[model samples]
Target: MVSLTERTRQGWLPLFVLAVGMSMIIIDATIVNVAVPAILADLRLSATDVEWINSIYSLMFAALLIPLGRTGDVRGRRRMFVLGLVVFLAASALAAASVSGPMLIGARVIQGVGAAMVVPMTLATINAVYTGSRRVIAFAVWGSVIGGMAAVGPLLGGWLVTDHGWRWAFWVNLPIGLLVLAGATRVPETRDPSAGGHDVPGVLLSTVGTSSLVFSLIESQRYGWGGSSPVPYAFALAVLALTGLVLVERSRARRGRPVMLDLSLFSISSFRYGGAAATVVALGEFGMILVLPLFLQTAIGFTAFQTGLIIASLAAGAFLSGGIVPRLAKLMPARRIVQLGLLCEAAGAAAIGLVVSPGLGPWTFVPWLALYGLGVGFASAQLTSVMLAQVPSRQSGQASGLQSTMRQVGAAIGVAALGGVLVTGLGGAMERHLPDRPDLARAVRDSAGAAIAGIREPATRAAAVEASAEATRRVSLVTGAVLLAGVGAALLLPDTGGRRREEE
Candidate 1:
């Protein structure tokens, strides 16, 4: 058997294969959103069941990333990559054939595990195979795919659900998976020669810490943060687990055993700040993605298709910026470019907040969203290159895993924190504006869609719409503020002039 390294000297084929596999994972993250209503109706799923179906994949995926990434480093990246593809492909098939909600959720959990294995390897492999300028280009393409696919997911899901039904969303992964598998054969196998025996305690601690933390964040929106809700308990458990992980990893290092996370990586200023900026970027990006559709549909009366099309403008901007940033890197430092992107995002979000209203047209928000997307494209395209540049090639797998873990945690928090803001704002608006009818106001506060549908009086409907519009406006502003914070974090990154040579 020809080795993957010897077969493809230029490395484009392997890169393309990695991109395709990654696209599957990134697309799956948001593709299910547009199909949820259809799935619920077809499968007779309760609201809780539907929520779990949506949340469980991410929960499992985030939890297993560090452990699996370490496994790939200890074993072989290519081998784990192939195994991940197999698991993902099988789970996709099971999900497509699912007869009940529980079956689908189960399949999704397995799918998340596969995705966890596949994601870190893509970047680690690129870090290994590409050198200098080519390495910079490789990471640019990787980042572009991530940003572009996330934006495309909802549009693609809407089209698939509208035309071929919800099952095709999962089914579409089959051919792509096969193509990736075939190409995987040509990808070089790489691993850490110095990697020691796995620390089982380290794995358990990291898994529990991340999963519990993510679960608490995700569930806090549904189950209020106070009282007997599991949010506080889960959060406390997360803190305990994470602290334990730190102690255990330090012990493992002292004992000369492999640990899941290299706490030492945090010592690098670029890695530390770059990871922080990535998290903040994700918080703004994912929060906006979640809240925009709600505002468009509930406050502005756009259909799902119409909402998706408007959202596509964001993707369009991201694609345009993604293409431009690699060249821009030639002219400016990566840190400055990231700061510029965050500025665009902040400005765009602020613009949206100012302009969003019940009377606003659907097309009115497109330009602002596009600007925000452009920011995402620029930041995402270079941040990975900026951060991973600091890590030695041998440690690329663990670094990539940590990078991904930060982004996931950011996303989960973005949704929960920004989502909570929207909910609270809406309730507050309704309470303040609808003082005459407390019951109706409470109903509207509880469910925006139900409020829109149930309120028959024109005055009441108008008040509810205004309340929703206000809530959305506030959320947009908050999202902008979050991105602005990312700007400050981006400044901490060493001003490496966008030269791949300099990064190396």
Candidate 2:
């Protein structure tokens, strides 16, 4: 077998393999957004089911990361990473074949499982395989992937769905996954010799707690936040279960047992504050990503392909910033760069909110989204540096795992929160504008604002379009506010100057 030294010294091949794998996983998370209208045309999915299809993948992925990441540390990161690829590929095939809403949702759940297994291991594997400048560059590439690929998905999914069909989006993952697997041999295997004794209870509690919370938020849009729905019940379970998880993990840590997450890491101000900002920023960005495509196509009358091309502006700006950040690092602190980027995002989102109208062409969104993308680029990469800067080398894996989990949690909740706003906001518009057409309003709301594009009745379609525009404005403004909150959190960080100072 090739040694870690031998394999990694082969230059950047291992990092390339890992980055491809990571990119495929990240792309899948947002790819569905640009395809939601097409999927609705085929599956006849309800608004609730649409939210499920959009969010369950993330919810499960977020809930499982910490536990699976620790498992990777003990059981061989390479083994887990390989398994994740196979599982994700299989799940993609199943998703393409899904015949019903439940079928697609199930496939998404499996995809999330596969994603959870792959994501942490990729970071851990890179940590295990690289050192010094190589490690820094590798992690920088990883950060850029997270920030850029997310925005790029709409374009790819858009083209695939517009031309071949939405199913082709899933089909496209097969070749990428296979390519990664072929290169897997060059990636060095690693395991922690002292990693032992899994925290089974903590795992169970964390999963249950986080999943319940996400479920409530997503379902709350459909079931109503307060009424006879299970939203309240799920919220209660989440509160109780998450509290139990904290208590259980703390006890395990105190008694010198293996734990899923180290609570003590929060003692580091950078990790705590940086983490808080990362979560909100992800929520703001992803929530907007989900809603923007729906609005662009449904109200502005853009083709799926056109919508994708426009949204690609965000990724374009992000990649452009990726190049700029290295140069900017010499003149300013990383934290300052992060906060600056977030301010860009907030401004971009606010600008988007102000411009949304049924009469407006989708192209009006390009500059703002690109500005937002630039912020994502600067903020995400440097924010990561700030968060992990103070972490001890020995605890790097654990720290990375926790930060990843928090970001996933934010992404999952963002999907639900902003989505909930759109659905409920549209419903309110229906009540006010089309009071006699309750059934029509319900239909439009259940389609996740997709029906507005196809409603042939001129008056009704106009109403639906108006409603959709209002809902989108709400989503965009709320996204901007959340991003501003992230900016605030970034403001709170103690100078995270040391982490990236070496690069200067």
What TM-scores do the predictions have?
A: 0.89, 0.95
Candidate 1: what lDDT? 0.79
* lDDT for predicted candidate 2 compared with the true structure: 0.85
- Give the Å shift of residue 394 in candidate 2: 2.9
Q: For candidate 2, lDDT tens digit of each residue in 179-276?
A: 89999987888776667778999889999999999999987776776758999999999999999999998998899999988898898899999999
Clashes of 1: 0
lDDT of 1 by residue, 5-98 (tens): 5644855877877887898887775666656556755786643454456556766777788888888888888899999999999999999999
Q: Give me the candidate number with maximum TM-score.
A: 2
Candidate 1 deviant stretches above 4 angstroms? 1-10, 36-55, 94-105, 147-152, 221-226, 434-458, 497-504
The stretch of ten residues in a row with the least summed lDDT in candidate 1 is: 495-504
TM-score of 2: 0.95
Using lDDT as the measure, the top candidate is 2
